[model samples]
Target: MAPEPTSPVAGEQQDRSGETQDPATYEITKPLDEESPLLSPTRDEEQEGLIEDGSVHHDRDETSETKPLWYMILLTISIGGLQLAWAVELSNGSPYLLSLGLSKSLMALVWIAGPLTGTIVQPYVGILSDNCRSSWGKRTPFMIAGSAATIISLLALAWVREIVGGFLGLCGVDRESEGVKVTIIVVAVLFVYVLDVAINTVQAGIRAFILDCCPSHQQEAANSMASRVLGVGNIIGYVAGNIDLPKHLWFFGNTQFKVLCVIASLALGSTVALSIGTVRERDASLEGPPPKGRGGLIAFFKQVFKSIRRLPPQTRKVCEVQFFAWVGFFPQLFYSSSYIGDIYVQPFLEANPNMTPEEIDKLYEKATRVGTFALLIYAITSLATNVFLPFLIAPSYDSPANASLRAQRGQHTRLSRFLDHLVIPWLTLRRAWLIAHLIFATCMFSTLFVRSVGGATALIGIVGVSWALTLWAPFAIISAEISKLEEVRRLRASSPDDNNNNNTTDQAGIVLGIHNMSVSSPQIFATVGSSIIFKFLQKPRGTPGDHSIAVVLAAGGLSTLVAAFLTSRIQDEVEIPEGVVVEEGLAAFGVLSS
Candidate 1:
């Protein structure tokens, strides 16, 4: 027999039922069918109550649960602000390291550290949130606290820079005292790293929280919204950071950055609060801290480890693919900017020897702005693709297909075999698109060998446009397809004749987290690995490191085709679970025909 329902769990459902008789005293006349929605997705929440075999299971419909749209918008804005500040700092804050005289190698080391945290740290945070229990809700407290830390750290970084300058001055090393300032700068950098970790903690929590609230059928739409929000936020943040204040250069320094930090903090805090405030926390056992003891930490880890280990086979498969995909993609995170600077900017200057350093700097800045714009274009295009791709799958829009579409309501498509042949580019072109992108990325990266601004500019534009055309949409499409398959599985379980209508909600967060991990893990590996590789290839030390890294990037692009091919193998595994109506219908049709 399953464990008995705890008091907290009983009380929550009581409240949900609007002051009804105590759940303990209530009669369960209706059998809890597989299709009946759980009060919460976690498995433990499902076995609380069951009715006699003849009873019809009536679930409190999942559709009623939604955090308001404005709350979601606020979350989006907050995240955008944070991303914007980070991007600006990533681009401009480096002057501090250079001015303080850190070696290029050391600077790279510091840069590598950020991605390092993303690789392991984020998943840990995500897992923690998954099991977290607090009256304030599992994720919001972390979100608010992390935002506070980010604001404080951004201010501290600027102050640390100024303090180092002053200390060096007092020590009588006024001019070219960069070497003397390394220690102070390093300390500040360490602080910034702490801040980054905190912010990422909140980001991970927010993602899990979003999954927690959205129904399985709605996940694809939610994921699409997430992509759009991220892209929009980044674009806005970048544009805001790039705002040139000719009238108040002094204000634009630390003061301006500090102000932005405050705004970011407030935005995140408000958004987090709003996101959770109106939404009810259903799992009462999760409403307070875990039991106190030294074993608590150990127990927590044990639980998390079990959660990971016990993941269903499908989830594990997704994790493996994610890991490989991330590994192949990591190099681009650090290399993108460097690629622009070296392949285009430096080459342009070197070839135009007649131009002065000042002239080159001016031109390079212009070129970089253009490059940034290209990236923004790519971001927007990606958003559009994600929205439209679902319609093209397997005659989803055909009138006859509407029955399957409605039955798979949460699945969000009109047809069962939406994967048959894509419309816009055609479903058959899916693998081809993946191959083409890798080729594009490789070819674009190879342009580092080109020595002309004009050629480089043209190449950047092409790559930017191509990437923008489909990057966001492809993932959305793939995720939607898989999610729809999962939805079919859930519906099959809901059938009265089936014994396995399980609430599979817990899998969604972990799956999405793993998906993020695939994307992030590569960033970590690529950032560190590429930096190390480029270190050997740096000018004067090694021969044409920029070109070499580009070649490697091109290789990575080619490798993505391998991932694309493997995706086909994974595709067949994403079918409706056994005894699902879709599968049963097909079987019955086969029997009748025979």
Candidate 2:
């Protein structure tokens, strides 16, 4: 017979009934000391896999402190690769589609594939990875498979026209035929869908891997490293988007989009391979097979619904804020480049009224590159914000008691002391998030008055501050709440008189998945809404002054205003004992860490 599963701590063992013995029941060989680390409430909480730094520790073979700094860096670099691909897509996808003769309205519909796939693929992959029992480990196999798919789909998307043309030629179809054009567009759309699905799978697996590998104490550091790497990737991606790649690197591809795809594929494949090769994952098969029947699609959705219903008040409020925030973010994320490009092209269109179609197309491409430069500015500002914002805002775990302890210990450097003096004590994470929402709303609305490329660039660059906070704050809030929920579940489990037996489900994966749903579901609404606006409000094709994209941006601003109000309503403060002090570590957003 198989041996009973053992708990991480030495004196804790699973009973025959599969329940952990109460801590009170465990025999003590030595007299307990009041100041003993084992007896401390903070230590108890850490043992329960909940860290105050907002890093969720699930199951892992080693502590992050035991791992070398280089190892942590390598492990987290894959997320940067993921962000690079995403940045490239967000910066150039719409322009590439327009180049292929797709209408602006239809282009919005095509973009819906991202949120649609994210809604289904991310959660399903999260659940699936959780239950995986492969020799290569639960997360490794999925990351490898997802990375391969992403590389393949990205290449296919980049070369879609060539692929479709080759197939049409083989079938003796005329290249100039309307049918041929429609077929090429259809293939490109399908490839975009596949690419989005593959990327989502990789993203979900990478995040789970980080949580599973990092120990309780170092969760914050690991996450911070990942975030910084992601920021680097964003910077590189936007910079590349701004450059004239065809002029500088003709060997990579004929067009800028194709070259970016090749670069992203190489970056993703190499980073994933490096991490997979260097990291020795624990064999999950040793954990025993996943619970039977829970792997099915119907069961998955049922669990999701159950999780949604059981979300904690704090988590539910965070989700509400995220929903509206994403509604505000979607238009800027997908359309800012196009919006700025349209503005840049307006004057040129008037100056060259009798320009040829090819000349007009060239002008649009040039204007899009300028817009891409603006996004580059946005990326740079966001990276700077991610680096400096942590010191300016108080951590979620910080309290006056902990502050006094840090001060007594002489741990504050001169810079930190100055920052502390400068920081308003009332500027908590929730309030900063609220401020970010307000900034985003104001910037989005500012587009209504922007007529020059410079003004648009300035507005977008300012939005970076909000973007950085958006990337960090919600996840931090939700993570703390989830950790609290996990503690409650553990407390109930250890209670002898507690009769509830259905608390076996892992709260981290389920709640995080639900949070992801909140972020993604709004994108679907935003895309559909933008499409309708484009259909009705956009000027005719080849018109000189189309402000439909601006209109969508303003709508997003309105949604962000709602998010700001909801953010103000979220309760973030909780009382902590005077002696307990959890160290402040780096915090970052979920997917794009830095």
> Model 1: per-residue lDDT, tens digit, 132-218?
665555566666776677667766665675667677778887635556466676777797688768767767666655544444333
**lDDT tens per residue, model 2, 359-406:** 878888888889888888888888787777665565454445445555
Model 1 residue 587 distance off true place after TM-score fit, in angstroms: 18
The models' CA-based lDDT, in order, is 0.46, 0.72
Candidate 2 residue runs with Cα over 4 Å from true position: 1-44, 47-72, 216-224, 278-282, 399-423, 483-501, 505-507, 573-594
**Model 1 shows how many backbone clashes?**
10
- Candidates' TM-scores? 0.67, 0.84
- In terms of lDDT, model 2 sits at 0.72
TM-score of 1: 0.67
Query: What TM value does model 2 have?
Result: 0.84
Q: Model 2: which ten-residue window has the lowest total lDDT? A: 584-593
